[model samples]
Target: MPAMTEPKLISGNSNRPLAQQIARRMSLHRGMSVSLVDARVERFNDQEVFVEVYENVRGEDMFIVQSTSNPANDNLMELLIIADALKRSSASRITAVIPYFGYARQDRRTKARTPISAKLVANMITQAGIDRVLTLDLHATQIQGFFDMPVDNLYAAPVFALDVQHHFKGRLQDVTVVSPDVGGVARARELAKRIGCALAIVDKRREKPGEVAEMTVIGEVTGKTCIIVDDICDTAGTLCKAASVLMDAGATEVHSYITHGVLSAPAVERITKSVMKSLVITDSIQPTEAVKAAPNIRVVPTAPMFAQAILNTWSGTSVSSLFDVDTLTPIYEGLYHRG
Candidate 1:
């Protein structure tokens, strides 16, 4: 068997800091040092995407780290162009490490003449010569079916669980995991189960996209520390509203652990002004200046987890073990299951 070539990472402009952090974490995992590919991903005069890989990637495994975040189209285009460049350079394998998958919320058609944008985006990635995908906490788990190639959808539960354990410590029994709406009950239940806490759901009636008609708490949260678990925080309208409803339901305070902080306009402002004690999110989407300046919002680094996932993928190891609480290390320990 031929010796496996070291994997080369190529990052688009979407989240260079995260890409660099992942690269550094990977280097620490093993004796062999993994480095980023010398690539220049820039725009032309008319705002068109361009890519150039300076190093020889012939037969080398390549991974592109790019999040389809704020400028979704531009970043997504950069990823495709980079993949095409790598394919032309004879790269043996190309995997897309998309931390935040945009258009994921549009996985299904809600009305007539509506497009399933998530499926369309999956097709675009597959057609770009990419062989596999590694993404964190997709908005809709079913979106994995849209991809023709191998797709690894990792959960942020381990990271969030660890943080919860650390923050809640001796008061773990007083913490209650909450789902902002019915659609997220499963996600909330999993976290609550992992943390050995009571589970609750916010029965929210949304009349429109950004409006909540009514909300009612489904479980006992009186005097409990409520923690809402969600995948993305876009406008934060749902989160802020949920927090208010939870507080009104007699919860002492509310916190949130979201996988992606796609904090669009007024999200930070809403979170800052809301009664929620804190809003914790992963560094899946690059944080803007306002998010950084917000007092109630905190970001957890996904680099360590993503780095381990990438290493496991490269070694043909079981990536799912990373989520097994029993197998996790001290820094990322498993959540306790109280009877």
Candidate 2:
């Protein structure tokens, strides 16, 4: 087979630190050189987004690193405009590397007269001329079908498992993975299986988005190190409540491993004052100053995993193995080398 075109990384304003980290890891690849594209994504006086590519990317494979997080509309627009700009510049292929896809929680309608914003966002990306998508842990896995192009949805379980192993080095048998709600049992089960620990669920009566009326521990958590696993932690009302409930149920310690820390509003304060031992989150969303200053919060790097996935997609290698628990150790150990 002929050699594929060199891949170029580009970044929007959403999460430049993470983009730089991914680019740095890619550039460290043994026999290949990958670099970020020199591009300017600016705004007009009326707050309209504008993009200008300085490099001559006539036939390059482009990957735009943008997380549609806090300013969801602005970051999303920047991605779409960047994709359109790259398409107009004659790039061979464009892949959107969205670490945190916004509107994902709205994958379906829960009430009367509401739009499925997740599907709408997917359609917008398809219409914006992106050829493919590379994202991590969609709120609803079914959202992948909303796009017309190929979508690579990566999981963070392997990364979390490694952290869990390191955090509770001697007490693996005393750990229990707890899902904040029944809906997240599968996620918690996968993590527990990876760590060879027991599984538990918190049956919560959710009153609203961030509010939980009551919670009951469904399994034995007494004297165990409880680790709450969930995707998005917005206002954190539910997480805080769940942690207290677990502790009340005789859990020795409570820690959380949430993927996207959408720590909005009083989330930081709530988590800081809660009984949870610590909250470990990924850098899927750029951590705010408050999130950084919080005493009990820790952010993990996803750049190594993301860089590998990007390289695999460009080289047409299997990406599913990246999430395999056994393969992740080597994948993280040798990220700068070709697989």
Candidate 3:
């Protein structure tokens, strides 16, 4: 491959710190020179998004790293505008690296008149001329099908599962992996299987947005340390409430491992006072000061993992092995879960 084909990563305001870190990690890991593209993302007096890519990206494989987080609409628009700018600049291939894919929870219609916003967002990106996409821990994995182009839905399971092993001192049997909601059973089941432990589900009923009516513990967790797992913790309502329910169900203690710490208003305060022992989340989205200040909330750097994926993509190698759940399970099973 020609040196000119090397990736040029750029950042948006949503999570520039993480994008910069991923670029540095990639260069260090592969011994290749990598730097973010020189660009300016600004807003006009009327709050309209504007993007300007200073460097010539003609024929370069461009990757724009942006997390459509907090200011979801604004950040999202910036991504689209930047992709358009890169396309106009003659970028060979444009990949939008969204660490946190917004509107993913609305992938399916619940109410009669509801729209599949996830698919709509997917359409917008493709329409903006994005050649591909790279994102982490989408709220719904099936949303990958929404895109016509290649969509790499990376997982945080390997990171969370390995941390669970270390957190429990390699004693897998004593741990119980839990799903905070029935919808998350698949995710919890994967982690539980990796640890070779039992699985439990928290039965929660949602009355409306941001409101969980009731929660019940579904399986045995009485004598074990329960780790509640989920994808995104926007309001943390589900996590905090489920932790309380688990503790009340005779569990010794509770902890949580979530992918994106959206940590919207009151999320940090609720998490800090919750019954969970600790809450570990990946730095997919740049954590807020409140998230950093919360004692129980811990942020894990995902730059190393993303760095590996970026290198694999640039080298024309398959990036699937980076976080393949099944491949990682047997290793832990042999190490400590053996009878």
Candidate 4:
């Protein structure tokens, strides 16, 4: 196996703090040698997008850190331009490290006329000259197959599991893991198995994008402390509604654990008024000011995990075991259920 060279970290305008955190984990600051030129990215009078990258990236193993979160178009364009710049400047390799990959929910088309936006995004990235991709908790695991190049889908479950263990040490006997919807059963099941707790599912009906009606619980949540788990919490509609349902089902307390916090449009207020005790989210997407100010929202940093993955990848070691569920099962089981 070839030893990986020191990677050059570059940041677009998407999430500077996260890029800084990842750099800190790697024990290196952002490279000062390459200049990141901020070009005015706006549509013409007719409303068309344009981009430019003013930096040189010749012969560098460049990594562009950008999260396609809110204001997805602008951030996506910035990433594409930066990758193009690196490719044109003859960079040895360009890796796109996207903590939050937007449009991931569209991995497959539900309706006949709808497009597979996730595949489209993959095409765009590949065409933009990105040699590889590293993203966290993609909505659909199969989205990775959409890409032609190597894709590393890192898990935030270990981070969440560790935090859960730390917070509820001896009181895990009454805990129950929950999936906010049927689509997320796999994720919640993994967490439940790790924590050694019984699992529950929330069956919901979506009226529209930001509207949800939680119907019922699939498993035993009655009298149990419920932790609703999901990949992304955008409007907080599904989470809040599911929590309400759980509480009405005699759940002692309702909490939420989500991977990406894309808390958009009135989500803060919704969570504030909801019955949830707290909503724990990873720092995949940079939290908005509203999210930062929300009292019920708490953030868990993924710096250590990302750092470990980067080191392992660079060292030609297997990163698959970083958070093996089987290895951590005993720890989580003891913390959550076994006492």
Candidate 5:
């Protein structure tokens, strides 16, 4: 058994496989050997939620792994209920490890009479007694401000950069990183810098919500293999559209490295028929059956990154520095070496 402040990992019903993988990573190489503790979260006949922490969590620091993905409302309730249970059980500290933050896209009022649900969700978690938050590749960085507590917004750029480098190993110079929209230029640029590639942008305009978007290439992409980058790939409508424009602009091939794969509705079918060579997404959301059936879609695990973040946070080290190539490369190598 680990000590009281050893940072126990507890998971809700969301993305249990990811939680298990993270547990395995943390337990590697005779380190702390911390594993997940059981926290049974279930519902009643009338759909009322219930949570029970079997382990003695008194004074123990706990991190709850829950991605509010599809069926978002149910998962959100589960997270809140579990946190409430842990708090009442005398847990010293609780960090909500949300890999895919739901309602994050609604950080601001896009239209009149609409709710700022992101802030609402943040407030809900804070009121539930979570001391901190750990989430990956939020749809908006400003969502951190919504949380009054300490929020660590981890990036998938480092992971995607390493994978991109490996994929385009010898032909690195031929790769051009692209942003699917002007909004994502920063995220795309970060990955581009990490990969030592040039950057491009797709200028797009959206007139209304839930409508197909049109974009045009605004940078040199001729005869290059383009990798469009963004934080979320929901529905993949704009993504596939951008890929088509890139190919029309004479890009040899097009791929995307999106952090969240919210393949809602016809996303899988759209991507399957898109001009992109491949659509690489993180397992931030558990891949659905349709997502798995797509031949051109690749799913990458984010568990190792989360594990490192958890360990560093518990040890009072800098979790933000893990995105630096100088820092994360050796760490990832260590993971493979251990394997």
Candidate 6:
């Protein structure tokens, strides 16, 4: 495969610091040489969105860094407009590097007349002329199938694994990896394998939106340090409930490692009052004010991983090996010891 020329890194209003960190790792500046047209997004009297890009991007390989998180619709619109601008300016190719894809949990219709909002979001991006996408930890892996163009679903396990190691030192045997629900067992199993620990699952049922009732435990969590792992934590209901159940099951301590801390309504409050020792999350979705102020919340930087992935893709190298399980073991051990 022939290496493509280096792509210009563009940024939307979401997580600018993360985008800058990735750019620094790649030894480039954001929007280098090319004119970055800032889209001054506004609302009409009735509250509809309007966008216009102010600069040129002709003949460049474009990578727009945006996270469809929090103010979801606004951020999504920003990404669409940026892509449209690049397409209109004759950019050679456009890639939407959405570290956090919102509305992913709506991938399936649970009722008779519900819409698959995840698919709708995919359609919107596709229609906006994005040639490819790079995102991490979709709520459901099948969501990738919804996209017609090339889509890279990066894993946050490696990132979380490193943090766990650093915080636990060499006592991997005492640690138990946990899945907050049955659907997350595979994810938890993978983390347990990488970290060389036993695995457990929390049997939980969502009584209703934003409410979770923990029913049982699938594996042994007794007298062991438990780390609840999940792709996203929106309301914190499920996570807190699972943590409580693990404690009742005789787990020594409870901690959580979530990919995207959507940390919406009462989430921080719930986490603050839960049995969790700490809530470790990635910088995929910028945390809200409450999340930032929470003492038990710690953020693990993902810039290096994303930077390397972007560079590898641009240089026409295989990224499959980047997901090596062994490489992450030591990193997690180190993080465990530090904590």
List candidate 4 segments past 4 Å from native. Answer: 1-4, 28-56, 325-339
Query: What tens digits encode model 3's per-residue C-alpha lDDT throughout 162-249?
Result: 6777668656677899999888999999888776889999998988989999998999999889988899898898889999888889
| Model 4 lDDT per residue over 192-306, tens place | 8877888999888877666774478899988899998899988877788889999999999999999999888778999999999999998889888888888989998865566
Higher-lDDT candidate among 1 and 3?
Answer: 1
Better of 1 and 6 by lDDT: 1
Best by lDDT: 2
User: Scored by CA lDDT, what does every candidate get?
Assistant: 0.90, 0.91, 0.86, 0.80, 0.88, 0.82
lDDT of 6 by residue, 193-239 (tens): 88899988788776787766547998988889999999998888888
Ranking by lDDT: 2, 1, 5, 3, 6, 4
Deviating ranges (above 4 Å) for candidate 3: 1-4, 325-339
Error at 150, model 4, angstroms: 0.9
Worst 10 residues of 4 by lDDT: 28-37
For every model shown, what is its TM-score relative to the native structure? 0.96, 0.96, 0.93, 0.88, 0.95, 0.90
Taking the tens digit of each residue's C-alpha lDDT, what string does model 5 give over 28-97?
A: 8227577789768888999988998899988988899999988899999999998998999999889999
Which candidate, 2 or 3, would have the higher lDDT against the true structure? 2
What is model 4's C-alpha RMSD?
Answer: 4.4
- Residue 266 deviation, candidate 2, in Å? 0.7
Better of 2 and 5 by TM-score: 2
Q: In candidate 2, what are the lDDT values of residues 155-250, reduced to their tens digit?
A: 988899988887788889999999999999999999999989999999999777656778899999999999999999999989999999999999
Candidate 5 clashing pairs, residues 3+ apart or interchain: none
